[model samples]
Target: MKLFFAFAIIAIALSVVYGAPADPWNEYKTKHGKKFGSTAEDAQRKKLFLAKDALIAKHNSQPKASYQLEHNEFSDMTPAELSQYLGAVKPANKTRSLESMVRLEMETRQLPDSLDYRTDSCLPGVRNQKQCGSCWAFAAITPLEFARCKKHGALRAISEQQLVDCEPYDYGCGGGWYTNAWYYLQYEAGGAAKRSLYPYTATDNTCAFSSSMIGAKISSYGDLPSFDAAYMQSVLQDYGPISVAIAVTDSFFSYASGVYTDVECDDPNAYVNHAVVVVGWGTDNGIDYWIVRNSWGTKWGSAGYILMERGVNKCKIEKYPATILSVV
Candidate 1:
């Protein structure tokens, strides 16, 4: 009995020390999972991640994970290239993970064949949905904003928060897709609450009318091609960056800094992550990379983005592409 009591005390102490481990990732799941899947089951994958050293020992040959900056673009790029491409690096720039990956993106000129995964309304604050678990709305609606700009020759930030608050016709905050969001906005007569009108609070709430609210008449592209590398590249080359979803890497959790290539060792199962935006692609130092935007806020990653390898292109946006737009 005494031994059991001691073990119980140790367990309680560890819990307090580590803080509540109630899947601290739950908050992460709700926000990022929106576009990845309707249910958390799709967005998250289970994996037993061993420590870096342990992983090396298990793999025996050393997985060749580049955690340090021996070849990162920021460290390797010349001053002229840095000035033209990256400008001057600040102290904070030293720690960004996607820095090396973006070098490949900057050189790419490939454009998609047509507009896709974009909307007429180009809104900001993808991070706001983290609380609401409304990532799909952000993912689905963003393409609309960019597409409309290209189609109409105009530029403006739309509102994802408005979608969160105004579209009571859908699943509220639990989660919904961009296709459904487009339908919701279209049915609401093309007037969606703008960011100022209905900002993202991350909580499920009632949709109240606001005067300043403005949004595009949500439209569809018939049926978008499956979300894949070929499709994503084609869209970017022709239209622009396509808002997309994919399996996020769990090492994305340990990603304090450094460019992420396939060489970066991580749990594959944990990589089934969801995200929005496919900026562009290119090659640097003879390696291919994909430029991607993220909603985790600029402070969290490569200025709220990441560089994925072109060959590593995986994941399929479940639904067809949709977009956000300006109502007036």
Candidate 2:
């Protein structure tokens, strides 16, 4: 019994000195279906996983934290590796000046205290963008899908790969702006192809666009003014979903739940690096937030969604709101 107790004490001391046991790492790997090419690779991944897990625990322990983090598919990835997921890039020159774009008139009536398009069945299931930086394509396609549902009474999965391949103004998976994608659909491609016909490859491929597979076409697209959450809500209610950009930080990669409000991402002029869809808005415990949809798959966030603090243009979310005006 004495010997057993001494061994146990040594084990505890070892854990305290080195870190926790490998049980959590093993379980995380299994949960995420993570596989490594070799033992060395596995060890490196485990180290990264442990470091991320510690950061998550530390952040969650803070009593005043507005959000939480957890081990998900990105848990084993390094910060540099995780950044590959962000693909939204700002255009060097606007296709049209922000002032020239049609803005939604502010609604005079009272907006709903809470709104969610997912409950309305207008939006489709969450999609995974994988390792490719094709978030701009995904973001651009979702609002079009929503508009189709609103206008035609049928929700259709349009091909994001079409934009990734055909849009000459934007750099396929390297990164892109949704407005440029819209311009391609409007003037160049004429229309978007159905997902069933032209599926997403998550890679830059030669344009294989066939006009015969056209599923949906937009008549016109417009941008909403920045720092106008009320107008954004009005547009969402009158129209459908709006494609917007946000400033993604290191903390954003591990976001699990709660209203995401980070000081680092609060700058109005902060570079918006990722594109997402704003499906709706609501107040949670007195804090207003936008129900933003992400393309990183259901394993991340609240089944591939994040509640961004609204009204304050949190993470530059309200900076560049663009949407299709009418579906054809």
Candidate 3:
């Protein structure tokens, strides 16, 4: 009896040291619906999971952390595996002239202090890109959907899969730019299909696009002023959601809540790796943040959204802002 009691005490102490339940590995797997092919694979994944859990705990424990980290669907993924979700590639011509692009005529009026297109019922439900590096497609499709809904008074889920399969310039799932996807919609595809017609397969498949399925068409698209947050804000207020690229760091995969501000994101030369939609902006406790929507589904972040630190151009968010002027 004494030996058994000692073992129990030891287990409790180990649990305390680990800062997790007695069988956190099992608990995590069960919670996330994880399955491993073999016991060895399971062990390897458990080690990775524990390490990530520890990092999350360490970051959240910080006294002045602007954001908090939490366990989610990505808790079991390695840094490399998490990176597979980032599909936004930088455009070859980083300094593409905006002269050919349509420009929004700014009105000399006070912009609202805060705005969220999600609440206006113009935006569609948050979607899961699901292991495919299709962030560009989601980012591009969302703003067009928003513009169409704003003008037509009906919300529709445009097909990201259409861009994934049909956009000749992009390498579907390998990585692509939202701008290229936008160009494809404007010219080649003639528009975009509805989600019902060409639902996301999350893979590089044969282009199954049909003209009858085209749900929305863009009249013109344009890039906002580089690093100009004020201009970006005005455009977002007038036009709707804007597609932009940002650097996705290690901490970004585990983001849970609060205004996300990472030191790595502040670097001017940081690689812009993921495309996301800027839905709105607001101030939280004197800290201004852009309300951004991600493509990782409702399970990630705050119901498939994140608040990024605004104005400082954190994560190069204002670098490649693009928006659809009108949808037919």
Estimate, for each residue in 193-276, the C-alpha lDDT of model 1 and write its tens digit. Answer: 555555666666666656456645444332234434564465465555565555443344333333455333333442323436
Give the alpha-carbon lDDT of every model.
0.46, 0.88, 0.87
Point to the candidate with the largest lDDT.
Answer: 2
Clashes of each: 31, 0, 0
In Å, residue 287's CA in model 1 sits off its true spot by 3.5
Worst 10 residues of 1 by lDDT: 82-91
Clashes of 1: 31
* Model 1 misplacement above 4 A: 1-63, 66-128, 151-154, 168-170, 210-212, 256-273, 315-328
Candidate 3, backbone clash total: 0
Question: What lDDT tens digits, residue by residue, belong to model 2 across residues 1-328?
Answer: 9999999999999999998866998898888899999999999999998898898999999998888998888888887788789988898888442322576666577898988987777799999988888999999999999888889998899999999888987788888989888888877789999999999988999989999999999888889888888888988988888999889987898999999988888764568889999999998778899999999999899999999999988998988998888989
* Model 3 ranges off by over 4 Å: 1-21, 94-100
TM-score of each: 0.55, 0.91, 0.91
Looking at model 2, the pairs that clash are: none
Candidate 2 all-Cα RMSD = 3.8
For candidate 3, the 10 contiguous residues with the lowest summed lDDT are 94-103
